[model samples]
Target: MAERILIVDDAAFMRMMVKDILTKNGYEIAGEAENGQQAVDMYQEQKPDLVTLDITMPEKDGIQALKEIKGKDPEANIIMCSAMGQQAMVVDAIQAGAKDFIVKPFQADRVIEAIQKALS
Candidate 1:
């Protein structure tokens, strides 16, 4: 079965980009969220195999959402999404239990590689 993924991003365009990339690569989209708060809510409701989370968002950041999800499901597979020069946030995400991360303006191969590595 295709792995289910929850896509979380504040921007509609970003979400669409990710969804396009993921679906084309044979991954099922379990759900989508526009902010960190929504992300946490969707995490519990959908319980997708993996999550692609944006670092900066309204109502709560990715790191905070990641923590909340992890608190609920320690085995959750979360991949933080960041932009250039957000190394500090990325590190925080890693320390907070994210399985891996993807940078924005995403490359199809890099995103797939990260997801594969995380799943493996």
Candidate 2:
């Protein structure tokens, strides 16, 4: 079965871009979130196989949401997304239990590779 994925990004364009890439590659989009708060809520409701989370967002940032999700499901699989130059945030995300991190202006292959690696 195709992996179910939740995409969390404040920007509508970014979410659309990710959804387009994953859907074209046969991954199922479980849902989309405009902020980290929504991401956490959707996570509980959908329990998708994976999550693509943006590092910066209103209400809650990716790192905080990641922690919340991990707290709820210790085995949750999450791939954090950040723009270039957010190395510190990336490190924190990894330390906080995110399975992987992807930089923005996302390359479809890289995104897929990260998700596959995280799942493995």
Candidate 3:
């Protein structure tokens, strides 16, 4: 069965780009969220196999949302996304429990690889 995935991003375009990649590769899209809070809420509802969270967002950032989700379900598979290529933020995200990281202007291959690796 395709793994259900929750996509969280403040930008609709980013979310659409990711959804297109994952669905085309046969992964199931559980839902989409526009902010960290929504991501947490949808997480409870969908209990997706994985989630791709944006590190920077309005309302709540990915780090906060990742913490909340991880707090609720330590096993949640989450991949962090960011447009800025900052090593500090990436390290912080990894320390906070992100299974993987994907840079913005995402390459379909990298996105697929990250998701697949995270699920594994």
> Model 2 misses residue 64 by how many Å?
0.5
Q: Can you write out model 3's per-residue Cα lDDT over 1-120, one digit (the tens) per residue?
A: 889999999999999999999989999999999999999999999999999999998888999999999999999999999986667888898999999999999999999999989998
lDDT of 2 by residue, 2-112 (tens): 999999999999999999999999999999999999999999999999999999999999999999999999999999999999999999999999999999899999998
For model 1, the local distance difference test gives 0.95
Which candidate has the highest lDDT of all?
Answer: 2
Best by TM-score: 2
Report clash pairs, candidate 1.
Answer: none
Cα lDDT of candidate 2 equals: 0.96
Error of 3 at 22 (Å): 0.7
By TM-score, the better pick of 1 and 2 is 2
35-72: candidate 1 lDDT, tens digit per residue: 99999999899989999999999999999999999999
- Segments of candidate 1 deviating more than 4 angstroms: none
All candidates: TM-score = 0.98, 0.98, 0.97
After superposition, candidate 3 runs with Cα above 4 Å error: none
- Point out the higher-scoring one by TM-score: 1 or 3: 1
